[model samples]
Target: MNPVPDLVPARMVSEFVYCKRSFYLEWVLGQFQENHEVAEGTALHRKVNAVKGSVPATSEEKPFKATSVQLSSPELGLVAKLDVLEGDGSFSIPIEFKRGAPQLGDDPVWLKDKVQVLIQALLLREAGHKCSTAYVWYDKVKRRVSVPITKEAIDWALAQVADLKKVAASHKIPKPLIDSPKCRRCSLVEMCIPDETNALDGKSAQPPRRMVATDPASRALYITTQGTYIGLSNGVVELREDRVTQEKVRLLDVSEINLYGRIEVSSTLIGACLERNIPILWFSSGGWFKGYASGAMSGNVDLRRRQVLASITGALDYAKTMIAGKIANCRTLLRRNAKIDVEPTLTELTRALARVKRCKDKQSLLGVEGIAAKAYFSAFDAMLKAEMGFTLEGRNKRPPTDPVNAMLSFLYAALAKEMTVSLLSVGFDPYQGLLHEPRFNRAALALDMMEEFRPLVVDSTVVKLVNTGVATPDKFQYRGDGCIMKPGMKKDLLRAYERRLDETIIHPVFKYRTEYRRALRLQCRLLAGVMMEDIAKYVAFTTR
Candidate 1:
């Protein structure tokens, strides 16, 4: 059996929404491992929570207590966690912590929020307090948005709970009636057939794209003296006495440039792509890559591109300060959360200062030199599980170990693949990194950068899977005294991990909660400008 995570079903939903496979393997299988993203997220949250005296999100130790508490409704069979409960002056207020900004107009708030308030109201009433309205605190707004638990909301909550019970009892997962635009990030896409994809009157951007069966390796592109070419085979190209760049066959476009082979592709032609931000991922034989991009002009978007450029320069200039500010804030949060004086690692702080000085040139922390991360990861050994599966007796590096480590290694492989996707979107080389040591299987820089997002994205999600029995120990197998995942494990793991990425968490930087999955992509875009030598500064992600 796996250890239970310290969270309610809602938390699990939030986690699974980020990535389904992560949730399944961690929550169900009792398998655990940590990557840079998980570690970074964990450290940040620990720092955030450690500030307890008053919940002044900025203050490390001072937290203002939420006025009211809510207990699960025994009579109604419902569960909820309220953030703050206000007392119409006489008593404390009831409030709830939400991951995103509010979308209030005229129509009533969402059913989810209403149900949450209704439960809080019921709990307060049971506690001998009269409550009518509740506050919905958005982390993005950093203020309380008022919401009343009306008769309608209460009635809906009761009915939904009953329906939820029935749904849970059903062995098979139910497909979403309408696909939430957010479902693209849902880990359950493979399992749940949400109508949202086909329910819409027309094609929408929200539905998840089904996997394509084409082999990426089979598709190829190149430039030669003959012209530009795209194909699925190496034998198609015809070479003469000289190099391919010497001959112009048929294709025509912008300026041509040389590449891996004697052939060349037109850079000017590719430049015409509209609002281009898609990243390119180049996997190397040794886990490193050479990347290229064209999205560095985000801020300078306008007619003439000059007006936009002028303003963007100013914004990029400010981004450097933002980076400095973020590091300082992270330091402070750490002090408050862990109750330890995490003095700056850089005594001279040369690397940090250098990054800010050349903000537009450096896209991320991984690009910042002189900082070592492996030691920091070693400090977090207790929080991570040994990779399971595979065996080589007493020797670890020479061969393998328990099934868990093998699983973790596999998980890392997937992360590497995803990192390539993220880098391409922002137009960077996923392989050339600042923090990681170059090696055969190393995506060092990407690995270094991912450390910050791991806790909320992976570890916590895994805990949910195990605690809920979504993955059980029995699902694994041992052969030759080596533990390894059973045949069906990878698919199951992917299902849960996808959901976890889809889960929403209040974005620490944007102040609006977005899918953990989407956030990863967005972060890559911001780094692009820094790489293109365009931005005046780069800002590291931090609590907004």
Candidate 2:
């Protein structure tokens, strides 16, 4: 039996025309960012295309009009949904509605927009319609720009369709354009890191991070409650508590399984998870990172090699930027949420930001970070609502003396796991460090990457959990020297952490809204870009 040929979406051709790297990121990696421009365009199309009752929109000059027509060409392996067709059955022209203003003659910026309609016309022609010309209506200008459907345009689009099919089969990402003006308006810029990847010197920079599909349907299973037993059953993983099945999910649906202390997992299940490339992370009862059981190394070896080399060569710049991000985020968080005046802390953070840029060595960078952390955390006590009974005397990690410190430590550990997973997904050696000291059997690179997120993720999460009464003193048990969280409390914190990761925020560089989880991956990819010298500067995720 002959295998079915792969079909290429007509819109992807437009993407390839816009930027080959963007096309790869979208079509291959399944990554996307939503921004105001994208939203505006979507809304505009929806409004224009939602014309009811098939009452064809006809202009005084043209007597025919049809909206939202689906056309496909099986021989070409292409499918398209034409926005508007404005001719008779045999002879028709495609009218594409764009949200942008009309551009003058031979503007390269509108080339992709023109190619989009040309592809639609090609598909229409293959469907037994004669399309000689296509029109693009600009919403801002209220003018329809006519593009002739020439032999050359048809041949170019057909070749691109073939190229797109090849790309689909090969699964190789295209190189990004360096400092392209078109990148400023591209929605995928944050994820693509065009500037960073394009800036890499082929000799010094490492290979760019490989693009991996992040399944939105996959879920993370948190075994928070104690006495829970995990086992394999009929290609599905079952969770039981007190001999009662609490949940059962097919192994395919699970991406990662995290278990707190006292949770038991059968060896069979562990092996099954590892075989399926699902990582299993273990946390202490008090939410401390113990270790993780994951599948064998699956990423590119050269990427790891480059990560080690780049960490040493770019240590100073990486260290400085990460610390600056941490301090800036700390100041922003204090100014926005702190009940008391944060003028002093903000001033100190400002000076620290300035000093961080001038740091020539890792030692100076660490010193600046230490000073910023001191100033930032000193004001932490004032930010908490007095009713919560959570106070932070200082940032204490080992055997946290206060409930706040315990939560912070636990949250930081959780963030570490997230960063490590993200780095691994992008084929980085999580043990190599630029900002943090590398230790035996430690993911120091994850620690280094998490520096920027400490204030943005952990600190903010703890503050919300306490101030909003989501987590109270009763949720934490006071031990001889430290505080511990019960399984139930861990469950609550897990819920909050997952929610925080799922929360969407606007990325400052791309001006696009992305989930915190995907943002972590973006940061990792950007770091890879920097290591490869694809970009000039590494921009961190800083909150307003």
- lDDT (Cα, tens digit) per residue for candidate 2, span 1-544: 1122466677788888878878866665555656667878899889557543232332223346667777677677878777877776446788888889876657422777877888898877676667788888888888888888999988888887777667655534567775566776777766676654553433223323323234477778888777899999988999998989999999878878888779999999999988777889998777777778887664344456667787767667777777888888899889989988889889999999999998988888889889989988899987899877888988987788888888888889899989888887666788888878788867888998888788777888889998999888887787788777765667777788888888888766555566888778888988876664445577777877
Error of model 1, residue 544, in angstroms: 10
Q: Identify the runs in model 2 with alpha carbons over 4 angstroms from their true place.
A: 1-174, 177-213
Whole-model alpha-carbon lDDT for candidate 2:
0.77
TM-score of each: 0.33, 0.65
- Candidate 1 lDDT, 217-290, residue by residue in tens: 22112222222332212222222333333333222221112122233333433443222332223322111234
Give the alpha-carbon lDDT of every model. Answer: 0.42, 0.77
Query: What C-alpha RMSD separates each model from the true structure?
Result: 25.9, 11.5
Best TM-score among the predictions, by candidate number: 2
Error of 1 at 320 (Å): 14
Pairs of residues at least 3 apart in sequence or in different chains that clash in candidate 2: 196-534, 196-535, 197-534, 199-533, 199-534, 200-533, 200-534
By summed lDDT, the worst window of 10 consecutive residues in model 2 runs over 52-61
lDDT leader = 2
- Model 2's C-alpha root-mean-square deviation from the true structure amounts to 11.5
